[model samples]
Target: MQATTPLSANSAATAPRTAQPVAARGRLITDAPTRMFHWLFALSFVGAYLTAEGERWRMLHVTLGYTMAGLLAFRVLYGLFGPRQAGLGLLWRKLGSAPAWLKSLRTAGSLTAVNWRQGQNLLMALAVVALLVMVLPLTLSGYATFNEWGVFPGEDWLAELHEFFGEAMLFVVLGHLALIGGLSVLRRKNQAAPMLTGRVDGPGPSLVPHNRRWLAALLLLAVLAYGAWEWQQSPKGLVPANAWSQVPGGEASGGDDD
Candidate 1:
């Protein structure tokens, strides 16, 4: 079997890259901006989640939550207007084939007898959608909770909902990681490395030509600046005003906490 093949522009446009041995250093399959978004989003969620429990880190938590919201905004704009391969539409297209993929399973004697790769792709698509869509609810509810928006009907309901979204996102994230692990084992290659290095094991021109490192750098800088600004705006030395002694514990004091 051929280890690699030349990727012509025409075939690249026509073919669907359904999770091959996509890892290591070779031709680029992912651009810098996409990779930057992925890592920053992950870090923001993790940092926010870790600091969610107490008053001590409330400001930091709020800042991190806002960071997630901003990152989501960036992702939405980029996916809508960015490169074709990195577009959100690609995921939607994968999801569009779900009906047919599900229909194919009915003919199989056993579920495993069906196209596993196709199923994997569908699951991945679903996971991505879940993660993306959950962000809206997560950040919205988080913002409300931080403001103590409603101490009325079903007191703390918003907080509970925000927590629920966080847990749900965590579940989907774990599943995504599992899918990557399974793909790596099945393909006898480190599938996760491609995401880190934005490359795969092949010899040809990059599928995503522009690395766009400048954009990634700018994104990183923007997030950092925002975090620092939030810190400085807080009443205390570095903590946000809310956490210092404002509305209540876990509440943002004042100034662009959103």
Candidate 2:
């Protein structure tokens, strides 16, 4: 019988095939309630701002303002008591390392990394803190003005302060948008899409499990119901009595003949 030839390392038949690694897919990061709060908060701000000028829109404006206040309250509670990823504990921990975090940013190759591990965490914490700072003053001043809550400086002063804070908040929001755009471009990620879809591109297991979407839906429904009820009870002078009635010489016009 002929002896079988042994395969050599150089032989193609004997070489083992190398398996290619699978690419990482997107995973759920933000929860449903958090995402809902984000978009609703944005809409409430915009609605309140756009309706600020006219008496006819004041009801809508006040309703939106109250909505914002409620949203902020919910966020505070949620942050304090919510999930691990969404809780204030994480933010507090990250903030506690502020010095080190800032230092890391200054180091070489921080931003250049293909995956900036802590970038999202840092960004979210900073944004949350800044928004809370801005929104508190804006909300308080608005409420005071609407309710005539205090007699300190006077309603005029309160209104002026409200306007100032509103403008400042707008500026902060613009800055936030600019920063988000820059980071998205640098990181090659769709940062805004995460707020809408509650997911981010990355390897799993996800930081948070499946979201409590039902809670988000309930929260939204409650807010809408409250807004509608408030709309009905809101001052008619502020709520548009009639569209045509508010025209220059229409019945709703209160100007006296000169």
Candidate 3:
């Protein structure tokens, strides 16, 4: 048989073919405000805890509290109006459910739901609840102490309770930070960085445009400022009259001057 002529060097090039660009890996997850609120709240909570009693520091602490409250309120609104991936409903819907692939009766396949981190998610949720529980009392008590309301005869009990919750919150926060750090290191994932950039990897819905987020953030700032201004201007916020001074023969023994 005659030796087959060697195929031309350009033969493969002439053959029909198709080329498609590979899709980019990773996608955005967290929104801008969500990220900003995370870090800012983290810092403010730490500051408030450390300088809780000092006069000048209390100003910063109070301002930060109002800011944190505003951020939390904004998060609620954003969850409703923002992207699906960042929305509260989406995040929590499948949370308590078994993984879709693993819910079937078929035993022939590996269980996909087996690896779901329900414990971790629950832990995070608990931390959030604890933070809120602690903060509510702490914030209200701070306001009470500020107003000098002396609702319970002496504000000492309220003040102590507020401090107790505040400290408790700090402990939980430290745990949260530790979890993030550990997860990042173990998975080689930058969990902390996402809060700064408000972006995340993996499949997710489209991000809200920066412009919209900016407007939302501005409104948040306005509300926060209003809260702070109100706190400062409210007459009840002045330090309370000392109990000893108000008592018989105890004049000059207690009060702000003391």
Candidate-wise lDDT, in order: 0.85, 0.80, 0.65
Residue-pair clashes per candidate, as listed?
Answer: 1, 0, 1
Write the residue-wise lDDT of candidate 3 on 1-258 in tens digits.
888888786997798878887775455556666666566667767767766876744655676666666666666777789767567775455544434424542553554634435545555655665665566677877778667666566448767877777877888988977877877886798767766655567676646444256754776577567756866885544233453465588767532553
- Model 3 scores worst on lDDT over the 10 consecutive residues at 235-244
**Better model by TM-score, 2 or 3?**
2
What's the ranking of the predictions by TM-score, best on top? 1, 2, 3
For 1-258, candidate 1 gives per-residue lDDT tens digits of 868977899987898768777454688898998899899999988888888887778888888888988998999999999998889998999999988888888878997789888888888889878888999999999999988886686688888998999898989999999998998899899978867999888778888978899999999999989988887788653453444444456545457553
RMSD of each: 13.7, 8.8, 11.4
- Clashing residue pairs in candidate 3, if any? 147-236
Highest TM-score scorer: 1
Model 3 misplaced regions, further than 4 Å: 1-25, 90-116, 151-155, 202-211, 216-258
Write down the worst ten-residue block by lDDT for model 1.
Answer: 237-246
lDDT for residue 196 in candidate 3, whole number 0-100: 65
lDDT of 1 at 80: 95
Model 2 residue 18 distance off true place after TM-score fit, in angstroms = 22
